[model samples]
Target: MEKHGAETYGELNADVYDEWHDIDPTDAVAFLAQLVEEGPAGPVLELAVGTGRVTIPLAAEGIDLRGVDASEAMVARMRAKPGGDRIPVTIGDMADVDPGTDDRFAMVFVVFSTFFFLMTQEEQVRCFANAARRLLPGGRFVLECPTPDVARYDREQRVEAHQVGVDHVRLTTVRHDPVGQRFLGQHVLITNNGIRLAPAFMRYAWPSELDLMARLAGLESVGRWGGWRGEPFTGEGNYVTVYEKPATPAS
Candidate 1:
């Protein structure tokens, strides 16, 4: 993958990003609803809310929600959705956040493995700290990432294409130097009247590495899961970590 790949992805895939982004939209809502009820309530902030898969649904439940995304194109797509305009969304880097206003949330979340885009340990830790500052004391922060099952991946760079119906999805998974991880993304909806592609680039993180980041941000892990349904976490499973900001300093 080129250095500018992620910057160009949103513009390149805007159209299909609207069409197929919520492949499992309903099930996702069900899970988020469960999260809302089981965890904190009231105001919530959604990080990297690409096209509002979880935010829009959660907003419909009448929860006070604000969304943040780095992509203008993706934000635009979210605006066209059923409850889009009802929520306020900011456009900015997920790592830096949109940089200010004193509002906080009961919960802050990064979904669909969005956390990996930070690409560095420092940036990932910074994001946790930023989210912590945006929460009320004792608020929860949740992040989901695909476990870095480096074995299922290949060492060499590759460009592969997949299709969901007439929508053709192309992917480019390039292995970066230093022998650590891979970049995998799909370009969807190619055969329609003009094609739109959604390119996702993720640098997988081991569960232990992420736990440390959360710890440094003054957040502690309360739970880890294999999926959105809250399955137990493991080496081969996906990760859903729930961390809470201590009511006072960690000391």
Candidate 2:
């Protein structure tokens, strides 16, 4: 396992990210917008806000959103997009970067399994601490990721077709380390032009582990959903978990 930093993900995937990983964000945006609107009054902070995929649209909906990412290339691409420059983005590691001196957000979020990108429990805990630090008292910290499906692997390795088209095919190969609860994934893209490889490594955490992490950061569980649309979480599929910092007691 080669050591890769947080910037490695964006460096490898930024160019083709939107094309290869585009998802209809209608439901997610609606859910987040409503969450922000109904939560404590403050701005929102997004960790790993790649290419402004969700930030741009959420900002367009009149939510004050700020973002942080490790990759300058990804941020540059984001800046080129419509309304991208308007959203304040800091180029730094999400786990350690301070949002600002006086900045406190109503909500802080890391979506699409981005929390696993930290690759270690220490880093993940730091990220939770950072989110909690940036949040206002009683503010929410939300995260979304798919549950680890260990059954999908054979002998700790698996190859699956992600997408196939008339002129292009995308395949993902993964080697799982059950001991570490980590997966090293290599995405191969084959097209008429050529072949390209993009690698990503993640340390997957169980829902219980995530809840413990949040609690360690002084956050309390508020809600958990199986999907972005407020569906019940049945310990399967993707999940969105929300936690809230306790409000300060009056003096």
Candidate 3:
């Protein structure tokens, strides 16, 4: 399999992103929307904002939300949606954290495990530093990421079924690299008509490692939750972490 670049996932999955993922944005939207209401006044930025899944609804509710994406194809899907065109999106690497605007944001976020797409610890740290640079002092940076599950793989590989239908079946085969905390996967869709495959690659870091990245960026962890609704993090499952830039610049 060819190595996937930053834009590969969005290019391949943009069309089916909403349908295949089927994530309920209710909790996520409510959580971020509340932050927008309570936090300092400025526009919000979302990294890897593919297809406007959460961006569209928040924009519809009148949040001054902007976006950055690596893929033109994914951004196009977002632009085609209602209200999507109104949300300014910069087509670029999320790790770059450059939305190509003069405005610093009150909040910067990368949800739905998108941060893992950075593919390296150095890149992830760079993303944190860049995101912090894009934020207002005292502003928040939020991330939604799942805990690493080593048990899922047997001998460094795992296969699972995602969907089963009369006309089609969807499955994923993943190769894990424990040393690198990486996963290379292929989503295989088999239909009566034909077969399609979407390649995905991620370098996942534990929340503790992410905390180090934040600290290196001069940000501090203010909150950690197991879910979007402020549930306690019991050291398992997903975590929604909030890091804050200090109100004053670091000496």
Rank order (by lDDT, best first): 3, 2, 1
Provide TM-scores for the models: 0.83, 0.94, 0.97
Between candidates 1 and 3, which one is better according to lDDT? 3
lDDT winner between candidates 2 and 3? 3
Question: Residue by residue across 1-251, what tens digits does model 2's lDDT show?
Answer: 56689899998899988887788778888989998987899999999999988889999999998998998889889999999999888888889746554789999988887889998999999999888878888799999998999999999999999889999899999999999999999999999999999998999999999999988888999999998999999988889999998897333
Question: What lDDT does model 3 reach?
Answer: 0.91
CA-only RMSD, every prediction: 3.3, 1.9, 1.2
User: lDDT for every model?
Assistant: 0.71, 0.90, 0.91
Model 1: per-residue Cα lDDT at residue 69: 76
Candidate 3 runs further than 4 Å off: none
- Count clashing residue pairs in model 3: 0
TM-score: which is higher, 2 or 3? Answer: 3
Candidate 3's residue-wise lDDT over 95-124, tens digit each? 989999889999999998789988999899
- Residue pairs with backbone overlap in model 3: none
